[model samples]
Target: MDLTTRCLFLLSCLCMLLAIDLDAVEPSYYVDTSSTSDVIDYKDPCKAAAFLGDIALDEEDLRMFKVDRIVNVARQTVQTVNRTDPVTGSSTNEAGQSSVVPNRRGLRRWKRAATSRPERVWPEGVIPYVISGNFSGSQRAIFRQAMRHWEKHTCVTFIERTQEESYIVFTYRPCGCCSYVGRRGGGPQAISIGKNCDKFGIVVHELGHVIGFWHEHTRPDRDDHVSIIRDNIQQGQEYNFLKMEPGEVDSMGEVYDFDSIMHYARNTFSRGIFLDTILPRYDVNGVRPPIGQRTRLSKGDITQARKLYKCSRCGDSLQDSSGNFSSPGFPNGYSAYMHCIWRISVTPGEKIILNFTSMDLYRSHLCWYDHVEIRDGYWRKAPLKGRFCGDKVPEPIISTDSRLWIEFRSSSNWVGKGFSAVYEAICGGEVKRDNGQIQSPNYPDDYRPNKVCVWKITVAQGFHVGLTFQSFEIERHDSCAYDYLEVRDGNTENSPLLGRFCGYDKPDDIKTSSNQLWMKFVSDGSVNKAGFAANFFKEMDECSKPDNGRCEQRCVNTLGSYKCACDPGYELASDKRSCEAACGGFITKLNGSITSPGWPREYPPNKNCIWQLVAPTQYPHHPAVRRFRDRGQRCVQV
Candidate 1:
């Protein structure tokens, strides 16, 4: 080879050596704290949380979650120590080699969780990610593999960030591997996957932290499943072993699983191989396999994550004969314009009994707002049970039909904690008998706040259902913004509303126009009073003959009585048997557009025109103009 060609090769080798030397000299992770101790550095997502001092979980907030361990930084610096390879009989010097991460690695104890404190489930199970430019090609590939592992076992999908408001940025910094719990809305989260931290299992563990699962050993029930050895832990890391309170963390009903990928290794945080930290409890059943297997996700890990994120089963869909489901962001505000529909079915003959754990939604006195509507069957044409809003949970709803299709909807303006409900198909409840009485949930006692309940009373065919509230006392409000009861005729909500009674007064005895009657009661977030109780009995509200009110367009029957009525846009003629429409007049549903009769063509030279508009009783008719610009046409007030 020529000398010049050989020189170029040597120069390239020199550059490579220089890069390695620089990497070896990098400083260990360190933090400069402004306070002396336990000041709760909670405000910084970039820093570990200082000890919050024995803040045990309280009974009232069992649904709330909080992590006790911080992304702590051990206060030491890495120094080289001599190591001998037993197999090769060779000597080498390695920096901070130990069973657990060296005390100097600083960033410690993976923390990934968001207390119902303040979190919302990600939409569509997608998580956007970012990678710092400094990581080498090999390191970047490890990050991708970790993410793909999660995608393979679960519905979670991770993509590169592009103008996203929140994302995880893979950064190669001084801190040991660590990631902020769940979403911290203020900005992007930085996960430190530093040098030597890219092992498959370690990378997967850090990614788990980003998705919101706490370390398996930290679970409150860990004691029943595993024994924690305290003496083996590194110094000043007592906070790292703190266990969560019962219910403070949810495993999505998964059994204690030592095989979970979220489980810490037996020697995690230990000073050396002789010291181990986690041991699975032994039982009559048998001993279990070792934990901290970084190979892939365990069954419990995948199931819990799927349940927490609202993917498919677990809690999202209820196909079982008896089951329960909650809003998408349970224990948190459901997002705006959110729509979730659930179908519940029972055996060929049984009916469904739905009970609410809690319900809080945006409120509007006019009913022009967020609501959860229930139908007797799966189609849109199926009868609507009732429309409910406000902060209150509704009373228990019973369906005479064997199936129920429930849909939850939220408008764009505001949102609340939404609702949580459970339904079980009953073999023989009160409604199954066709003639029975119904009571408010927890009758004779103050109803729980934020509740919604519905009961469908059905009588045999050819007979009508009569209902009366025996005892009633709901929070008094002119519009019932906080709590109220609605009764409807027939099985659907489209059935005519008989009465929307609230206040302290008992409603008068009423009878249904058909064989079925639906009763729905809702309560707000505050001020729940003793609710009402109603009795159901079958009777006929039928007519012997049909008569168009002396001869008009139509006639209606009201249990033993009849009345005549004319369709909209027409009025009874002088003879009462005929009808006439005013010039340019027509009738339309509440949601429709109106235009001049002449349309896009020219009108006759001399003709006077007038029109009338009408709406359902719940929403009084109002003149609408200005800002109604969908048609690109001109309109004027008559």
Candidate 2:
């Protein structure tokens, strides 16, 4: 067999043994890196013109321009058969892969050759690009997938070019995959996607360069994390491993991330097939970290990108039951001319309690400059609880419902340490005290929609609950259906109803028939209004008024109502109200005797007799009493 046939057969066999599907293998696997063999060099007018070194440019400019060179397929193995087009000096390999010659006219503008320079970022993290018609349908899909991978993790966005002055042009020229670092001011910068460069990760890596990321190994602090093996590195490619000065690159306060997609594999730029140009160091735990992961953006990479673009740590949506949030750059004076908003939401039927731990901001009488505004609702238009500034921390703010909106604004003139705050979800409970106050969630302020809160006020038995409304305003409804406060006479919802109050009308005093009172506030998923507030206290004794209990004799007051009692010589009648003459009396002396009504004669029918015997000491003496009746009636002793 010929050398190519033998190579293919061996590779197919190896794939089968490894359980790898060769058909599913990405074209990046076909990269050729052998320096001994000749590879096709696609000559282009742009590359040649720049290589000629225009007479207008001086020595240093040319050197820097040379360092800004772009390449396709950064690091890969070499194994290919090249078929060159003699006329154009351009050729495709056995896998139909070719190299792209970047448009070098724009390279003259880039001066930082070895630094991880923060090149001009896309405005607002919005990038405009145009995909060349030369790409096949599937190839276009790969490009989109890579773009989406970056967008999914970071705040960066990619859109088709419109009339923007600066945009990216995705071109297919049979060149290796490559892209310029950061956005170029030129009219149309090109990101070349060659034949074998259509792999998802390869495209993603190239785009990382476009998004202003340097190789991970070039980080200033990389030496502490990775060790470079100079002996294994290719002789002329040593510059690729050089580290940037500490001040030149920004790590965004993140530690070294070995899994960054921008990182090179251990074998990158190796002098031999089996040589490794880079080796990871043991961590504090004596464990080595894996490197060169082209699967997705690393946490460090995402953080750095976000920091460069100022996309996060500015505003967020908080939904935890309890959490804390602060202004951007809190405790370290915030940036000038900044605006940030935070929306906090907890479980429904609950309320939010926000507490400011610290506050330091530019002081203004009207708080028109740098200040933080808090609202009882979830939007900008929500009722503003307060707008605070200066060194004084604001009072604790409680929401009427489960959501709160907080905003921070800073003027271009002054800034301070900003503020810090924490929040938690709070809601209904049982109030069993003698007298206290009860109000709707976030009463005075507008209540939130779609919430139900219950409050059970229970005092000592026999004491009726008295509630008086100080202020009342709810979502107006004729039937008190949308949003209303329902008061029941007992502790449970099934108790007898006192009243359902709603709208702007204030309810009269509520006095429960029993000591327990049940209150439930219900709000639908619609409009909201300021809820009601009321104070509850123990009402006066029900039997305090003269003859209030309708008793024919003495009256006694209980917790919630009244009762009747008979005098010494009288008995309680069957009607339970009238008092009748009785044969019993309280005997305070040493001894006493009692008899039935109309004693010596036959006692009246159905007459009740009673007597009380008492002694001054702890031990009391017992007295005997007898009752006499007519025929068939028996005499009983007490």
Candidate 3:
């Protein structure tokens, strides 16, 4: 036993005598492909740093940033990890909401609630939400996993209102996270999502300020790219760094995105560890992107949420900064029965290349006659990045999200020279997104020895493709046989089996009724771990396999029926199913707990139980004077 203890005793006797039976992977598990290293550039074109830095305005600094957005509207959660932003990839953990920005008012800015009152939107983008309190059962499966990250890339639609009059409550307070940047009418409104605001990018940045956006560094051209160091903030919160004012904001064109998941985290409200409130005006040769990356959204946040929820589309809608558009009167010939559409929008980690330079129209073979179609998102059911006519210059058509639609048909009799595409907005890796998160190779750490990865996740189309593993280390094997991780629901390679996961635990949710999900991550050139981090969102259609009466004791299906819930101390009874005793008559709230009744899971042959603890009777306790002693089985206390 030498040579590293005989390769650690032949990998612990080949992980307890092997196990790699995914319909027989034995061919000694091929597919090493030398490279499947899949990343497919899901466009995040980091050129971020778009001019806007150096601000400190007025209107009493916008009425002291709306009295500091109502003193950072609280409900209170307080996870408190501190170091709120020593910059260098900031650090925030207060989580119980307060969308973190108090480096002494570190300019969390994104103010828009007085555009003279009116711009609440969400009327058709549909957002009804609810949630209520005492949340648990893994916080309601983390509130449908932070609402499937805004139902996997916006077109909104949150549903579930019962007789709506103005919704969006999502409470579980001890407050802090905060919402209310938009639609703040009548009742329900709140948003809180307390205690570390339950991640998933702080519940999609407090539901993008309850679906109305604002805080992408408080726009108004964020001081030309970012550089707000007014003595590293904290001076009366310097009016939360005021700015916003050029028609206050519409940005549907997009650009100045320091990876905007709604930026604000340089050293947000700095004033410590050698202060530096928000720097980087340029200089990204070290390759950037990671300045508050709540993981998704940033294509200028789905291009200003598809221009603030007016998402119908056929043309006109672009952003950040770019120019040139043709096919309609471009140098000549282009009308007589036409159909033009141009949507360019960029900035959520950029992309949209297109550079046809010059062309003559009306071709054949595929263009069908008079064409120019490109789509990377929004309509034509996105994905076909090109469809040129009789052009010849069809190479650069980049965009994987951040919008690019572009369509220009014409055939009321030939239309030539009417083409010249030249669009810009790039960031690299050639990608096309449909919902993201894919890691394994060098993920979290350790992963890279004999590598081989493959990830194919498609979405949109009556959805269904869940996959959730947020983390899974490899190199172990009880049955995974050795460095496994095979998930395949369809997309070739004989698509079928949906499970294969390996050692280091973490592997349960694997859904795939179909919309594609084909992952593979083999590695065995000699052991290594830390490799796995799934997250494939979008799974709506299992309201308990079509029973959908809504809920009673247990029914959990969301995104329609507004995520019907109720199952933890039960309550939804109003003929909603059946479950009662909702604390108050001893349902004891303050965030759910207390079992023993039928818990640790069912018991008691003969029973009679009563429980009540409730907490805080004006806070007072401890006054033991005597003792108790029983002898049925000898119970004693003194």
Candidate 4:
């Protein structure tokens, strides 16, 4: 009972407390209670048990999953998964019955195979995909953008199919959204991008499965990262929470990533509202990392693919106003088997100008082997500006949008010093907003000579584009043939000309007939000035509204204003905002004159004008005998 004995006892008690603390934090995984002898069935994966509500795993990939168990899950479909809605908000059922489901913040919106087959990896990281004809133009655009999302971040590239035997065909089916994991050998493999699956993130997630990515939560080491709530999981969906063994699939030597786009949402396959089927074991200060991020690829997801495909980590998203980038190992020979994508985004009102300073790569007829491709927008499928190879440097490429996407690819056989380029944000770009402002390049300062800038403004449907000049100063011209501002009523230059203005006088406000408006400003080589500034806004429909422009009779909505009109015998009132009776009446005043309705402008058609002259009937004054001009009309009087 001395000091040594007491200290030793206290140390033993502390050790016991530490052991209990460790056990409290340890993660608990799903325990299999079903018999091991349970037979696994193989069938059309898309139609079989592999179709877990929204995900469809192929038979080969399905085998890697352990299915002989009852895992707890619940029905907590986030408001985001109402099936009919792609956005995250309250939605209604087929009977128009709505429920207010809580929104899963940051939950913006997959599976893979085993036995790594080289064929599973697209040849040369180039994939060919076909969009079904049944898809609308906007749906097709969404598919392309989904494909481009991967292309913009990884070495993987997508091309429209052209008689390729093995390719991915995107189809629309109302049978839930799903995609096969990896390439299905032989003919075209199908990926269903069905109703409510047109979202960018959802489509991207499906494409990830096509690119041979397994769900992050299914990793062999996922037991140490997440715990599946079997009671909350949907019945018959336990296979979704099963983990793959170590030998079945490779994790590319990466840690379990909770934010991977391939990871499922916390509430996925839940049986009731607010129930989470998957919960993370680790948290930073008690806040778990969000899963199922459909916005973009996580760092781990990108790294794993790059490592598996031997793709280079060279590209970056450049958002600076001005910056420079080059191919991997620029000025020095770049390694073979390289695929890189660089996206440049600037302010909304500015455009990007990319100029290559040097170029060197293996040249081919189509520049197919090794080349640098430039797109006019951030999407890889955007209009191709050029595909350059060899020693010659390409011309400056200007973007129609505020962004640009560039890619450099090299084959395993050839190597080169590669290319270097710089991008600058300049004036002019597309505008699609309710209201915004646009200014000339270096406005308030003398603009550069021999410059051409185009501005396109698009408002909401059923709304017209209205533009007003805030300030105006361009080179003087008689016919606006020199430096001037040209405006069009439509989205293209071929549309009807609205006005061409120059000199000091500011032109009047302009309103388009439709939702689109286009403008171009040109400066000659001889002269330059402070240029001009303008504001654009959406013009609402005045006549289509309930009040009918407050007009008594008919209301006609023009480009910038509304006018009131009366019946055949009536004309517009003096107030200009009302309709009044007018076609024919008695002329009692001697000093008054007679004319057609709506003079100065075109007169209304199918109208008969009749007037009775009764000049007091007392002093007719020789019946006002005077010469009357025919005025290009024959008078019939009796």
Best by TM-score: 4
Provide the TM-score for each candidate, comma-separated. Answer: 0.36, 0.37, 0.26, 0.44
Model 1: per-residue Cα lDDT over 287-397, one tens digit each? 566888888888887777766665543223343556777777877778777777666644323467888888788788755667888777533356977677776767888
Model 4, residue 528: displacement in angstroms?
Answer: 28
lDDT of 4 by residue, 1-638 (tens): 23211211121111111111212222212212121111212122345333434556444433433222211112222222234333333345564333322233321101122226676777666677766546653565467557767765676767655556778877765454776666766767778777788888898888887887767886767889898998997655654666655555566556778878889888988898799999888895689888878988888877766665666467886756689999888888888878888878654457888999999999998898899999886556679999999999998888876668798889857767889999998766677786765656645356677778788889999888988665678889798898988999998899999999999776888889899999888888998876776667888767797987766666766544555655443555566555533445443444443334444334454455554444444434222213233343444341
Flag the better candidate by TM-score, 1 or 3: 1
Question: Which whole-number lDDT from 0 to 100 does residue 181 have in model 2?
Answer: 61
What's the residue-level lDDT of 313 in candidate 2? 53
Using lDDT as the yardstick, the better of models 2 and 3 is 2
Q: Highest lDDT, which number?
A: 4
Model 2 root mean square deviation, Cα atoms: 35.0
Q: All candidates' lDDT scores?
A: 0.57, 0.62, 0.53, 0.65
Error of 3 at 533 (Å): 2.8
Clash count per candidate: 23, 12, 44, 15
C-alpha positional error of residue 633 in candidate 3 after TM-score superposition, expressed in Å? 68
Better of 3 and 4 by TM-score: 4
Off by over 4 Å in 4: 1-45, 58-115, 316-324, 327-354, 358-419, 423-638
Ranking by lDDT: 4, 2, 1, 3
Per-residue accuracy of model 3 over 316-395 as CA lDDT, tens digit each: 54443467777767877877567766666543334567788888887787778688788776555667866887757777
Better of 1 and 2 by lDDT: 2
